[model samples]
Target: MTLLVGVDIGNSTTEACLAECGPDGPRYLGGALTSTSGVKGTADNVPGVVKVVQEALSAAGRDQHELAAVLVNEATPVISGLAMETITETVITESTMIGHNPDTPAGAGLGTGTTVAFAELGACAPGERVICVAGAGVDFEDAAAGIAAARDRGVEVTGAVVQADDANLIVNRLPTPIPVVDEVTLVEKVPLGMPAAVEVAEPGRTVRTLSNSYGIATLFDLDPDQTRLVAPVARALVGNRSAVVVRTPSGDVADRRIPAGTLTLIGEHARLPVGVDAGAEEIMATLRRVTPLADATGEAGTHVGGMLATVRDAMAETLSDTGGEQDAAIQDVLAVDTFVPQRVTGALAGEFALENAVALAAMVRTSRAPMEALAGQLRSALDVDVHVGGVEADMAVLGALTTPGTRRPLAVLDLGGGSTDAALATGDGEVHSVHLAGAGDLVTKLIDSELGLDNRDVAEDIKKNPLAKAESFFHVRMEDGTARFFDEPLPAEAFARVVVLGEGGMRPVPTRHPLEKVRRVRRSAKHKVFVVNALRALERVAPGGNLREIGFVVVLGGSALDFEIPDMIAEAVAAAGVVCGTGNVRGSEGPRNAVATGLVDEHAGRTR
Candidate 1:
């Protein structure tokens, strides 16, 4: 009996399978998995490969000296990098608006008047409509008293903007209620003596008047051009509970489309350039027009250009380290339309506007020379006969076939960290495969960008785990609206917060978004990356670009073990009348170690 170990080096992980190849056949013994040390298909992965092989051998109760050879999958190094370019920007020329949602604002309704400081209210003429602006140094009681005194003198105090968080206290003391927005961090920046409008809505409601362009036009009696200029200001205040729009002589707001540059798609037949400002749908459509894409490049001196260059340079560095050619080409690109909350410029109070952005994920394809170098390094380090195995997709399909009740005419979807690969196998022994960019890592980035989480680890946790709302100390409401009870009281910080049900424990999401909103963003991001790529990949590999031609799809890889990814892909592909589910290699390992097991199986067959 000859004992051998097969290792599969993936973008995110390394896995090994051990088996005994005798005269009769191969007997599967054990498997092991660990995080890949460095980039897959590079010399840096030698330590990870050696560790996993030793682990697999130990699990099988075999000595390293007893192993005959170590086979590794022909890993194609795929490096994926993503960049977000904002197409739409909201710019306030001269501090035109204070559109931010404070936790608490007082009263409801619109108040328009001339802006004046609280100390100057006493000097106002009777019937002179003015909005009181209270600085942080001013006491809330004194401010309220001053407003009441000014009102008694018929100095109409139509509205109030306070620097401190005392809007509620001031409004409660007023005999006549008026809109009051508080917590204006940059209250000193409010243009005094200018016409301003303050609108505060009731609890659980959004401001209406200031959020409407026509309403702002009517309040300031602006001309058509001025009204057009103020449209972006209204858009920035759409979802705020309270807002203040101050009109200065030179104040203006603009919604501008930034020049994000263009991408050049180099296909087998033609090279076409698509503008990034045209949005993701248009770019993707243009990309499809150039079928069999050979490579892609970006226009010089632009955001997209810088992004693509960064990706290429990083890949080139990795290849150069492995003694391969330094020139790297982008093999695939995935563009997604998303919204990022960017801070509005020239704002009195810090305000964020949802700007239109295009997120591009570029994948670089390298030659097999890197993997060959890695295999050589592994052989010398482990002192074992290490040989590069078959193509990853073919080996994955072979291992997937070991699933119970699976047979010929099968397909496999390998959803890895960096890319999504699809392979279709026919009964006649013909196999077709395609690799596409954008998978788990891209999805995590999308979630982080879209939700403005800015923390990849948190976004990844949200992606891998379900969410819940800590409704009470003893109970929590899950993402599916089911209540889960606990014997112990939950942490105080988790109360009334959206938390991720991670394996470690309930980790509270740091954002202020509600449970449902977070859930929607997470699911939408996954659908955009995984579901879209799944369909795109399947169509590419399916006969005649028709999914119905494929008999069955077996999902394999680390992402396949996700709590929801498999189901999402299955539901997405089911419309084509296909059978799709996660694979169980050898009816034991679930959605993992497929390539490694396939290598051993193929090796055993060759020896036989």
Candidate 2:
């Protein structure tokens, strides 16, 4: 009998299942688990996968050389980024009270100017210039001190747009009768030395109001009608705080340019994306991709106002070098609005593709075709038999699950690490299958983000086993909504960390409360959402509208074995009026061995 090893390398971990083909079918043997040896969506996968197989071999008291065939399941990473766009359709002429976070503030408005430190200009500088000095390189305590120093140097500290958070404390030190605006986080949006009026008005008002718009006209002598001309300019301020209408001593007014998102951008790649040199239309195009200038105070990478210092420096350099052209370019760039929480994974795909047994691997950009990249990666990595047995990933997994099939018209949902893949099998063969973004990694990411725990291990703990906070000494809360009562108060320190699970219900949850709670909730929620969504997606692709007509669904993959995911999915399927449950691909041993057994079974069933 020849030995067959089936290896599945998922995003978070790797697994190997060994089997021996005999007259009676395939006999399962050893298995092992390890952290993913390399990148999920690349060729460098063999070594890591091979290592797990070797462990399986040794555990079965066998040797690698005895292995006749090795079947490796395909692994591809699912990368996702959040995209948000706040398109302001309706513009009210008078309601200038638009507010957002430091990472999100945008829109037009007006204020007066005055020379004051962040600590003194609270209420008085409402209609004046405000300077902010509470960022990383600046001192919060010494803002007043710096103002004094600037006065000594004969530099006028004219105005300030204070960070929204620091407004209450910092606006107390203004020497002049300045009006301090509290909510504007990008206080630096207010340009220094340009002591003039700030006005954010609208189109709807200029015609209707023969009278006034308090916020903008309060500081400047602009009639409501004139303010309408500047409505477009005001609307553009949705992202930045610096740009507003200015009335010079000559009574002539123009929209002045202010700097925002000038954060220093630090990227892994040495070269700028798309183009190298400036002044080219390509750069202009790149600027347009930046966003409509909603909030002028943030940067364009990592997150809102990312690399603030860098964006500022670049904007300054671009302006100084090309002045008007640069300003025009900034507006073009501002047209490309950015959503919140910028997501980026470093440039590891290239190195990741250089793996053993990897005949092909493709690295595609966000704007490119993903399947082409998959095809490319496939050809580069698995040079041998890239198309043999219709070597597609999800389809093959279904084939593996159905080799022992009592029926056709069956669907298999393989919930793997990087992405959730589903395949429907018909009597003729594998018919429909699809790959969707988001999976274990996404769950882990949510855990990491929500828990604020930089520790992935802790996050993983939260995902696998939920943690419950012991509300008091005798009572503890579990992830599933059940509460356990205890005799006394648990340790205060462990109040918020992940807790441990035990026989009596909740053993001391390993993680603290809150974090533990967040992780557990996120993990459970993702499982429910993904499983239900996957089923719904599959049903849409079903031959007919009726899911009840479909016979069987085999849930395979690591996630299928999660504590409650399988049951939850079963209930969902039952609700859909169909029978569903975890795959008994390997009977008592769990969902293991299905792929390898099917691989060998295909040979035996055909021969028999």
Candidate 3:
């Protein structure tokens, strides 16, 4: 019997699978997965590679020396970048809107009054309701004290908008509780003496009055035409716990459409020009018009230009680091149009309006120098014969063939973190593959932007784990239409709201979005990346871009292991009258460690 280890370094994860081979071929032993230390094919990945190998060895109850050989995948590293352009611009000359999610807003209910500076609040006439403005220069203590003194003098300070991260701090010290919205970055720009509305909801609730256009219209006594102009302001404040909107007569907010800019796709025959505003379908249609892209450039001084430049520079630097002085030119770029719900500048209600953006990942084909360097490092550390495996797609197809009921003339979609790779194998054993960007990381960015989570880690958790809403103390309703009962009561934060299934435990999501809404966003993001990429990849390998021409499709790599993704993709692929399912590596390991398992199987003959 021969014991061997296979390692596959992905953009986000590092995996190792162990197998024992004899005359009967190969038998599955064990596998382990961990976060990749850094970019794949780089020396920084060695530590994570060693960790996963050691874990698989421990699981198999085998000594490191007992392993005959170690094979690491020849990873095609990709560099991903994100760029945002605000599609909707509101230019309210005098009225400033503040709409953002501050973790700790204070008190509840709406307060409408004239805007007044904190220092001048005492000088205001009695009985006139005033909304105090506190700039960043004012501490929470002084702001609270000033408001209290003004109130004692019979001046009604109905509400307050502050610049510091002290909304809860000032509210707790107030003589009588009033709504306090804090963390306004442009507090100094807030127009004093203008009519304003401040609304703060109770804990775990979102402000309603400010989120509705009709509500703002009634409060401000605006005409229909004027109310229509304020609709964007209301939309931006939809999910915030607290908000403040000031009315400036000259303030006319217009939703100015920013040109996302044009992209120049250089092809062998001709160059195609597409605008970012044209959407993904149009951008991709333009790409299809040009079979093989030589290089892509964005118009200078535009968002797309900045975005493309960023990706190229990053890939060039990474390649230079690995290959030493070699000019790293980006061979190809994949662009996906996505949106980001970004907070508006000088917004009074902390509002976040949806902004148009592009997500891109650039690929630079590299030589075997990096792989050789990694092999040298591993040999010095593990004291084993390290070999760089065959092409990643070829090994994956070979491993995918181990799945029950799968055979030649099939296609495999290696949906990984950085890229979606598809390979087609003819009945006689010839394979053709294409690697493109926009995969798991792109989905994570979409989730983060749409939900306005502002935290990539949380967005990733939301993407990978099943979502549920805590309905009662004893049970939580899961996204799969099932309820999980707990023997002990859940934490208060997890009650009556959506929560993400985190490694530590059930963690509550702060947004006011319902469970179904969050689930919809998550699924939509997956569709945008995986489903779209699957068809795009297969079309390149099939004749006339007809998916029906392909017989079967087996999904490999880490993403195929997602709970709902495989079934979703399978259903979609079946529409083309083609059979599709997640690969079961070696008939035991399901949809994971394909490249790693394939490495061992492909190396078996050499060992013999």
Clashes of each: 0, 113, 17
Query: Which residue runs does candidate 2 get wrong by more than 4 Å?
Result: 40-43, 73-407, 446-461, 472-475, 480-492, 496-532, 606-608
Write model 3 residue lDDT over 293-327, tens digit each, in one string: 77788899977788777777766766666667654
- The model with the greatest TM-score is 1
- Model 3 scores a C-alpha lDDT of 0.82
Q: After the best TM-score superposition of candidate 2, give how far the Cα of residue 545 lies from its true spot, in angstroms.
A: 4.5
TM-scores, one per candidate: 0.97, 0.48, 0.78
lDDT of each: 0.89, 0.45, 0.82
lDDT of 2 by residue, 1-608 (tens): 76766555555566666778787876777667666655453444556755676788899998766876655543332222221122112222322222222322222233444324344434333333443323323443465555545544555444334444443344355343222233443344333333343322232222111123444454555577756654543433343333323333332222222222122212233213431112123422443244221222333542233333343443344234211332211111211111112111111000000010100000111211132343344444433222122233443444445434435667777676545666777777756765543455545545544444557665556566656665665566775679877666676755544575643434343323354446545655465345644664466446774677667777776777777667767777787666566677545446544544454445445434
